[model samples]
Each structure stands twice: as C-alpha cells, then as structure tokens.
Target: MKHLPTSVKCVALLAAALLPLAASQAHAATIHTQGSIQYVCSGVGQGSLQKMQAQAAKFNLGFWMVKGPQGEYLANVPVKVMQNGKTVAKFTAGGPLCYLKAPAGTYTIEGRHDGQLRTIQAQSGTTAHYLRW
Candidate 1:
C-alpha cells in the first residue's frame, strides 16, 4: 500500500475546507440600481431618486425613492449612521425611500430634515420604508 505525501494530504484538506467559501463568493449577488431617482413632484416629493441611486453606488448598496403621502416630500433629509463617530452609512438629502434588501447585520437607520427625525433598526433582507414630509 502506498501512503500519500504529507504535503498532498494537507493540500487536499485545505481545498475541501475552502470549497464552501469559494462557492459562496461565486453565488454572491450585488444589488444595484438601474438609474437615478427622477420622479416629478405632482405632490409631496423628495430629491431625484436617480441621485440616491448614484450615491448608493459608493457603498455598493441598493437605492429606491418612495412616494410621499398626499402633499409631503422627502427633501433635505440627512442620515448619519455611525458605530462610533465612524460613519457606517450616510444618506444624503433627497429620499423618501426604502431599502428592499440589505446585508446580514445590525444597522441604525436615521432620517432627519425639516424638524422631523425618524430612526429605526435595519436587519438583513428586510424592507426599510421612508416616508417624506
């Protein structure tokens, strides 16, 4: 009977352990927006969703703008989410938006502008809705 070399055995074990990691990497899907927000304000309106889309790109995140109720708009809203003065996520003005899918983690989401401030906890693959003023 022939015994496999120590190096060959180690290589085989490492490959087996890494198989799942390789597969997960390949299966990962990146969320992306097709275009910036560009909805006209027939009523309450936020900034261009297009702009949010563009901004989200910086974080490799997905973006969407929501419609305000009746006569409200999501304008000049700024969101700063920090783990400790280190901004984890910052949302620029112009969004009455929602996140359809997010990565698996705990996140603090805040929206503020025009004297109204709203904050919530974000979870993975959860939907976060933002209503405009």
Candidate 2:
C-alpha cells in the first residue's frame, strides 16, 4: 500500500473539512441583467407636459404622474409588456397614483390625459422617460 506523509494526510483532511464552507460561501447571489427606465419631463407651459406625456404613453409603458404646483409635473412610466400585439396590463397615469410590476415582454400602452392619447411599446422592467418642448 502506498502511504501518504503525515503533513499531506493532514492537508487532505483539512481540504475535505473546508469543502462545505467554500460551497456555502459561494451561495451569495447577485442580480445581473436587471434593468429599469425613468422619465423626466421638464419644460414651461402645457406644451412640454403634453408632448412628454404623449410620448410616454405612445410607448405603452407603465408610470406614475403627480400634478405639482404652478403646472409642474412628475411621472414614472414603465415600458409595456405584450404578447402577440395585445396589451396585457394597463397603467393609470395621473394624480392619485398607482403602479404595476409586470414580467418581461412587449406591449401597447395607451392612456387618456386631457383629451390626448399616450401609447407606446412596453417591455419588462424598463423605465422610459419623456421631455416636453
């Protein structure tokens, strides 16, 4: 029988003992390929607001909008998720806000704000921004 030296035997035992620790340590996880989209519409008068909102909806994304003092506004629109050219989810964008978290896909999103339409394509967990002129 071939015999290992005392030091080699000890090292082998230590390596075996540490194997589980190494695997457990490797269990720490990270998020990769996760993405988001944000919208910032800043301009004077209603033109910018209208254009920005119109563009946001044109893409069919989900977002939140809050009317601010002196005609200022804040909104967050997420890209719409769709399958076979149909809208799976809809977002209500305006004061008294709401939010939706959808799985990744393409979609058509439309909303009515002040007699205008906002429609666009939305994807999974994507953030889309718009600015008014």
Candidate 3:
C-alpha cells in the first residue's frame, strides 16, 4: 500500500539499510588456538571492545596496537607470540587489540608494520601491553 507517510517510509528504509552494518559490527569474535595457546584479536568499538574487555581477566597475554606520530590506534597488524625461543602463535591481528590464554610464563610479542618492528614482553601477571610501530 502507498498509504504510509514519506517520513515513515524513509525511516524504514534507513533502518533496513543499517541493520546489516550494525549486525556486522556486533558480530561475535572467534577464538583461535595454536599448540596450547588460545587467542583472539577483535576490532575496536565501544560495543566490541567492551565485549573483549569483559573476558580480559581470563587471558594471560594482552596487546594494544598503536601507531602514527600522535599515537593513533591501529588494526590488522601482523603479530607473533613466542616463548622459550619458539613460535607460540603466528597470525595477523584482526584488529587493534588481542588477548591470549597461555600458561604462566614470559612471552615475546612481535608486531611489524611498514618495514618497522615493535616488540614487547609480557608475563602472566601483566594486565596489558601496548605494541607501537
């Protein structure tokens, strides 16, 4: 029926167009595993970051990717997690933040961008770490 007002119709169309974007933004992140390590890298946004933060306590390794002269946030960075001089996990981060569930031990996190590399060390007790490049 062509009875609904123009304003109502516009609103309905807008909602329909945006529903997919909203759903994609809020999609649940997947947890990945390598050897004995379980990890996840999730994009940043109020809702998504909050979801990751809620489970932060369960992870022994955490990383925040940062870059730019003014410390702008970063995403999709290539990272590698290592322990005892062995590769533990190797993957490109899906977003600017990552969490890893690992045994209590020291770890080396390496991130590379634009031919530059940044490395950081983390222990089971450390809350989080910023890896800048």
Q: Which predicted model would earn the best TM-score? A: 3
Per-prediction tally of clashes: 7, 20, 0
Give one digit per residue, the lDDT tens place, for model 1 in 1-133: 1399988888988999999988755433333332331121111233234443443433422223333566344544566544334455564644344443334465565666666766655554444344334
Each model's RMSD to truth, in Å? Answer: 14.7, 15.0, 5.8
lDDT measured at residue 111 in model 3 versus the true structure, 0 to 100: 94
Q: Give Cα-based local distance difference scores for all models.
A: 0.46, 0.43, 0.86
**TM-scores, one per candidate:** 0.39, 0.33, 0.77
The TM-score of predicted model 3 comes to 0.77
Please give the ranking of all candidate structures by TM-score, highest first, separated by commas. Answer: 3, 1, 2
Give the clashing residue pairs of candidate 3, or none: none
Ranking by lDDT: 3, 1, 2
Model 2 lDDT at residue 24: 50
Candidate 2 Cα misplacement greater than 4 A, ranges: 1-71, 74-83, 94-98, 130-133
lDDT of 2 by residue, 1-133 (tens): 1499888899999999999988754442211121342323233243444544444442333443333344345343332323567545443333212223445566455555454455555564554522211
Would you list the clashing residue pairs of candidate 1?
A: 36-49, 36-50, 37-49, 37-50, 44-72, 66-96, 72-133
Better of 1 and 2 by TM-score: 1
